[model samples]
Target: MSASETNSFRAGRIVQLLFGIAVAAAFMLPIVWLVAGSFRPGSEIFTSLDPLSIGTFIPPRPTLANFGSALGGAFRTGLINSIVVAACTVVVGLLVCAAAAFALSAMQWRGREVVFAIIVFSFLIPEEVVALPLSAIFAQGGLQNTYTALIVPFVGNGIVIFLMRQFFLAIPRSLIEAAQVDGAGWLRIFLQIFLPLSRPALIAAGVILFNAQWQAYLWPLLVTTRADMLLAPITLGLMVGEHTSDYGQIFAASTILSFIPAVVLLGFQRFFTDSVAMSGVKE
Candidate 1:
């Protein structure tokens, strides 16, 4: 290429980099403000709010009191509850969804399409539309105010099944056929061949599912009325809003709560990214 063309190319690349950085900063500004505000004194949070102020960038007098309160106060219990619920949701959702996806993808049963359609249709039904009926069912089943109420209702996640099915469908049919030819039952074929190969899809589904369960608010609030039963992390952060409007504490707790999912996402980011990339590569 000519010298002028090369220089122009470099300049264009630099401009693109700058534009990308600016877009990223724009997206991250709210989170940056939250973290910064959390460190600031409550008085300074609302009054002296300049997101980019270097003077306010670092906490003037950093205190762990907000974190302390968050850990020891209502947040502590709520955080615990959230952990329990989210853990249960992730484990149970993965198991149930995986089994359902396997069956849908591998088997040829009567009315299979109809069943899959119904499950997908459930996703279209807004949570708010079903909340009232679900609450009543929980009340009748004596699951109200219990962990069962929180975990059981969401165990069979349609979206998880859908994603898993899509991934399973992409697997080589020869592997499944070979397993079957070797006298392997459906269970053995799924366990030895399908499950092992579907790690990427599982990881991707897990990350999405965990995030959903972690941040869940409305259903938990409806079912568990007792403070002791409150889930940790998100629930606790929310309770901070109700008990005391301490913005600093709220921000601190929220910032801390935010990190849990981000950390979780980051931990599996490579796997999730690889899964997406691999999905695009033709078999």
Candidate 2:
């Protein structure tokens, strides 16, 4: 290539790199402030209301008082509630979604495609549309403020079923056939073979669902009226308004609430990426 072309290419790449960094900084700045703000002593945090100000983002002294206060208050109750709800949702939801996917993908049946298509179509239906009805039903049945109100509704996630089904479709039919030839029933084949092979996809889906459930605010708020029944999102949100100009406690709670998903995603990131990419591949 000509010198001009080389210079042009280098210049373009440099511009792109700078642009990317700028965009990334724009996003990271807020998070930096949030974390930094949490560590700042109460006096330092309130010196200026400007979120991006150096004084607000960087404190001369850092302390853990905010974290301790938050942990002792709403953060404690909310964190426990979130963990319980997310864990149960992952376990039961994964089981039901994976099994449904297996039946849809590996089994010989009529209208399986139609059924799956209907599910796929249901994806377009927003959860908000059904939230009111579900709330009313729960209220009428006296299930409000109960664990059933939180965990039962999410066990049959359509998107999860679709993802698992797509992944299963890429599995070799010969393996399934061989299992059947060896007198392995569908359940045995599924549990022993399919489940083991599909661990990556299972974990990926579980992590996604767990994060969603953990961060859920609206539905949980609507279902339960009790103060102690709060989850992180609602608790942290309320904390923002409770203490006037107390950024430390709010940021501390936000950090704690965000920690779980960050650790989970970091740990399973490789598996999650592989599962998502492989789900698109065909046999």
Candidate 3:
């Protein structure tokens, strides 16, 4: 290539790179504001909003008092409760989803496609539509304000099952047949082969389940009434009052709440993307 042409290409590439960085920073501004606001005093949070400046993104006198308050009392309990609930959901939900996916994809059974179609349709239905009825049923069953109410209702996630099934479908049938011919039972094959090979899909499914439970507000509100049983999101809501609000603590708590799932998603994003892409590729 000519020198001028090479220079032009480099200039174009630099422009694209600069544009991408600018876009990323724009998207990150809110998160940056949230994190910065967390360290500011409650009275000072909105003081600098008249004219946008570096002060808006940077707290002049930062303090840990908000975090101290946020991590204490009921909010702390809520955070722990959220972690426990989300973790339990991920573990149990993954098992149920993987097994259901294996059955639908590996085992040749009558009405398999129909069952999967039904499962696909099920997740599409908004949870808000079913929350009231489920809440009533749980109330009747005496499961209100309990971890069982939180965990069990979400154990069989259809989206996770669908994602796993798609990934499972991409697995070669020959592998399953070979395992069967080697005298491996269906259970053994699933345990040893499919599960091991589908780590990326499993991570993706677990992230989805964890995020769902972590951010759950409406269902928890419907099922749980006790202060101690509240999840982080619900506790955050309670932190606000009609008369007064603790903006600093709220920002700190929000930062913590957002950080956990963001870290999980970032850590597993490569695997998640790969799983989604491969799951779309059918034999």
Cα lDDT of candidate 3 equals 0.93
For all candidates, what are the clash counts? 9, 0, 0
Q: Summarize candidate 3's per-residue lDDT along 1-46 as a digit string, tens digits.
A: 9999999999999999999999999999999999999999999998
Residue 209 Cα positional deviation in candidate 3, in Å, after optimal superposition: 0.8
Estimate the overall C-alpha local distance difference test score of candidate 1. Answer: 0.81
lDDT of each: 0.81, 0.85, 0.93
Superposition TM-score, candidate 2 onto the true structure: 0.91
Candidate 1 regions with alpha-carbon error over 4 angstroms: 49-51, 233-244, 280-283
Model 2 C-alpha lDDT per residue in residues 1-283, reported as the tens digit of each score:
9999999999999999999999999998888877887887666765676756677667767888999998998779988888898999999999999999999999999999999999898878887888889899999999988888999888888888888998898888999999989999999989999999998899888987887687677789889888888777887888766447567888888887777788998998887788878887776
Comparison by lDDT, 1 against 3, better one: 3
Highest-scoring model, lDDT: 3
Report the C-alpha displacement of residue 198, candidate 3, in angstroms. Answer: 1.0
